[model samples]
Target: MDDGFIAKPLGRRQIDQAYPLVCAIAPGLGVDQWRAFAAALLGTAPKGSGPGSSGPPAEAGIITVQNALGYMHGLFSYRVEPNLRHGRVLSVDNFVVLDLFDLAGIAETLLRAMDLLARRLGCAAIHTTLPERYLVRDSRRNPIPDCFRTEGHRQETIRFSKDLAVVNDNAPAVAGGLHGVE
Candidate 1:
């Protein structure tokens, strides 16, 4: 939404520019993934280009760059991954620069990214980490993103999840009463 900053997928060339920003974010992501990240962004950056323009888009991807006021303001890197529980969920893998003081178009841009990515991935849910302040509207309820919101959208509430052992259909499995195993 920034006047000049465009949010597009990370291409080889752009990825090189994004590495320092990403490293500034989650250093654990390492160097190699950053290289591949650039490769992935090329195909995903919006072009309105489709069949007539080229071919089907590439694999899972992330949105990069935020342009505002004719200069690059920040970067928002996001990706969707399998959630085994309710399905896939979006992660705002990186939220760097822009303005720690003023969160203007941040929400809108993120929402736009999520909407596109969610539909593209056919995901069941969208998710992301929000700062505590802007998250709370009027110092009350937490507003995640105008484009998206949690079920309760409470300040302190969190969605709980569990990882269950995936069992084969033919394998019989059961949870016994307390007396059985003891």
Candidate 2:
């Protein structure tokens, strides 16, 4: 679960490849823990990533990092274009960032998973309220990790947007419309 791990969607065939990723990190997780994770994931990820996909055996992409201290079981679901008072908003209907091992893993997994979700959903931007060390850093510069301040800076800011327009229209209007937002 070191944030260093890379996560990707797993097809049925590659799920087995996850064993090493799991055991390698939480070496002492035991049968019950594995069973619980398996059960939870089965309930959530039986088919693919989607809202109401399943329950406890939740659904989420697997995180992988060679020699990582732990792995994670992430379950997320969202209401895209959700109806709001005026228009619509993307509400994360179901989202849980869990670290099956050390607490430090929580920081790493949550940060990485959000980063992945923002990009995958074509979100203009993503946001979070976690305090700063929870904020990923770029050598700890003054706002070093502002998520979108520059290339490769996406990991730096917690309260960030994949595309600012999704949250606020006040952003400088783009000529190409929302497509040019990013």
Candidate 3:
């Protein structure tokens, strides 16, 4: 079925257009921050890399799904990294889909694209974790998990995280010294 939707690597020209879609999932990220991050992911102009540089790491990039009208509906950033257990693996993050009406189709398309990308990169496996905010408490009511399962992906591990309190760097240093240490 031709839904007039296509998935392709995000280009430097569409960074602004894709920013809104990214904000839909990452609400706290600012435009300037996202611009730099996207630039790095796109391997166009990584930090400290001069003009005509070789670009960022070859393993990292961002992919976006756009409609026939040239509007971004979803995006995911991925990088191929060496893993202790899986050898070289393709890790996906920041997966965001704004087209709620066709969430399943878009999600599936993105997953398939990741699969192809992983193979092309010679990755041993592909790992993806959906953002917690996008997941529903009711598993049966969530289509994201089903879409992943239908695409031959399995839930292998559960992730646990805790937000650490940020400390002010400008705060006075405590007067303490280790015993017998300079």
Best by lDDT: 3
TM-score for predicted model 2 compared with the true structure = 0.30
Candidate 3 structure quality by residue, lDDT tens digits, 50-161: 1122333347878888789888888898888898889999899989877758888788778877887777678899989788866677645777777888999888787775
Quick one: RMSD of model 3? 6.0
- Give me the displacement of residue 34 in model 2, in angstroms: 17
lDDT of 1 by residue, 67-114 (tens): 644234446555557777657765554555444543445545555655
Best by TM-score: 3
Residue pairs whose backbone atoms clash in candidate 3: none
* TM-score for each candidate, following the candidate numbering: 0.51, 0.30, 0.79
Ranking by lDDT: 3, 1, 2
Model 2 segments more than 4 A misplaced? 1-4, 10-71, 83-90, 97-101, 124-182
lDDT of 2: 0.41
| Candidate 3 local lDDT, residue 75 | 87
